[model samples]
Target chain A: MSERLTPHAPLTPAVLAILLSLAEDEKHGYAIMKDAVKPEFGGITLGPGTLYGTIDRLLRDRMIEETGTTDNERRRYYRLTSQGLKTVSAEIARLNAAVAQGRALGLIQPKGAR
Target chain B: MSERLTPHAPLTPAVLAILLSLAEDEKHGYAIMKDAVKPEFGGITLGPGTLYGTIDRLLRDRMIEETGTTDNERRRYYRLTSQGLKTVSAEIARLNAAVAQGRALGLIQPKGAR
Candidate 1:
């Protein structure tokens, strides 16, 4: 696993969904999906197995840590570790720059955007 | 499918594997996995079907184009368009910034890197 990630092990969309959710604070399994599957993911939606699979990977990678227990239940809450936050921010920066480049070439238009 | 990617249809690892490969030059199926996997992807290599699946998506997105055909064996060569190069560059920049941020906090180390 260590060798697998040494050069680059990124957050899969499933993982990204979890990290983006935790970036706000913390949440258990199902709650993450509710938040993550907005108009953004276009309802492709993460299933139970997929969500947990990503969670397990992130936990193993130390990109996120178990923060606390939930009130209504004992569902474990995962929060982005310093490393995870850094990874997410970095990915966002890369995405932003790509968008900027597209704009420069008129390849992508802002269009009717919010 | 378009809506699914409208806000953020990023390069999945499968997709990234393909893009990174094409960034250097151009190639077809088996070759992309050979180059992309190296010691990098940790042998989670792209399958024959997976490679083409991503290639199709990239074609739809205009990130790659079907260049001239192969010589010895005709495997459709895929090349990164200008837009593709920009995306790859942006992604690399994002990754570099994240690495820099990690270094700033002493959270990640350079170690004995090659």
Candidate 2:
């Protein structure tokens, strides 16, 4: 990612939401789950096992790291890495440019229209 | 997603690469596959059925439309929609901002650093 040396990795929204939440500040596992799932998924929630499962994968991929910060005694905190941001940035840039180009062509329109 | 009153839909990069390739100009199914898969996924090319499966879904969602722009007798061209751009824009924004924020926090660093 970028000019920095980083390993290749891909993460979906569910995993991304967790990283973004921690980007502001390191947070415990439960807090991350709360922030990520709030309003976006409504009543739906990622089980503790699923949340940690993704976290472990992110950790293994070097997307996130464990931090001392936490709000729960029973939970650990996590945060993003430099490579993580770079990867995220590249992914976003790839997407943003595409979207921008599409808008330039006036492709984004009402379903009935197109 | 960006308050455009567009419908909610999530498409994978495989699907997105297809749209981005078509963003510049319309191309038929096989052409889209060639443009998207080239140098990206390497030898792993998406089958016609898979390409159309996503295309049909995107078509139904209005992320793409048959542009009457085509280069193959057995295929058809496609282009993006305004709603698609908005959706793509929002998704990229979501990712970029997160990446930016993580960098700001210095969370993005080497694996051993954190």
Predicted model with the maximum lDDT = 1
Q: List candidate 1 stretches off by more than 4 Å.
A: A1-8, A40-44, A105-107, A111-114, B1-114
How well does chain B match by TM-score in each candidate? 0.76, 0.64
Docking class of 2: incorrect
Error of 2 at B70 (Å): 4.6
- The alpha-carbon root-mean-square deviation between model 1 and the true structure, to one decimal in Å, is 8.0
Runs of candidate 2 with Cα error greater than 4 angstroms are A1-10, A37-50, A68-71, A99-103, A106-114, B1-8, B20-25, B34-53, B59-71, B79-114
Task: List model 2 lDDT by residue over B19-111, tens digit each.
Answer: 656665667777788876553322226778878898898898788888774455676777778776666555434433444454455545422
Question: What local lDDT does model 2 show for residue A83?
Answer: 67
Clashing pairs in 1: none
Model 1 chain A is weakest, by summed lDDT over 10 consecutive residues, at A94-103
All DockQ scores: 0.11, 0.12
Report candidate 2's interface RMSD in Å. 6.9
TM-score of chain A, every prediction, order shown: 0.77, 0.65
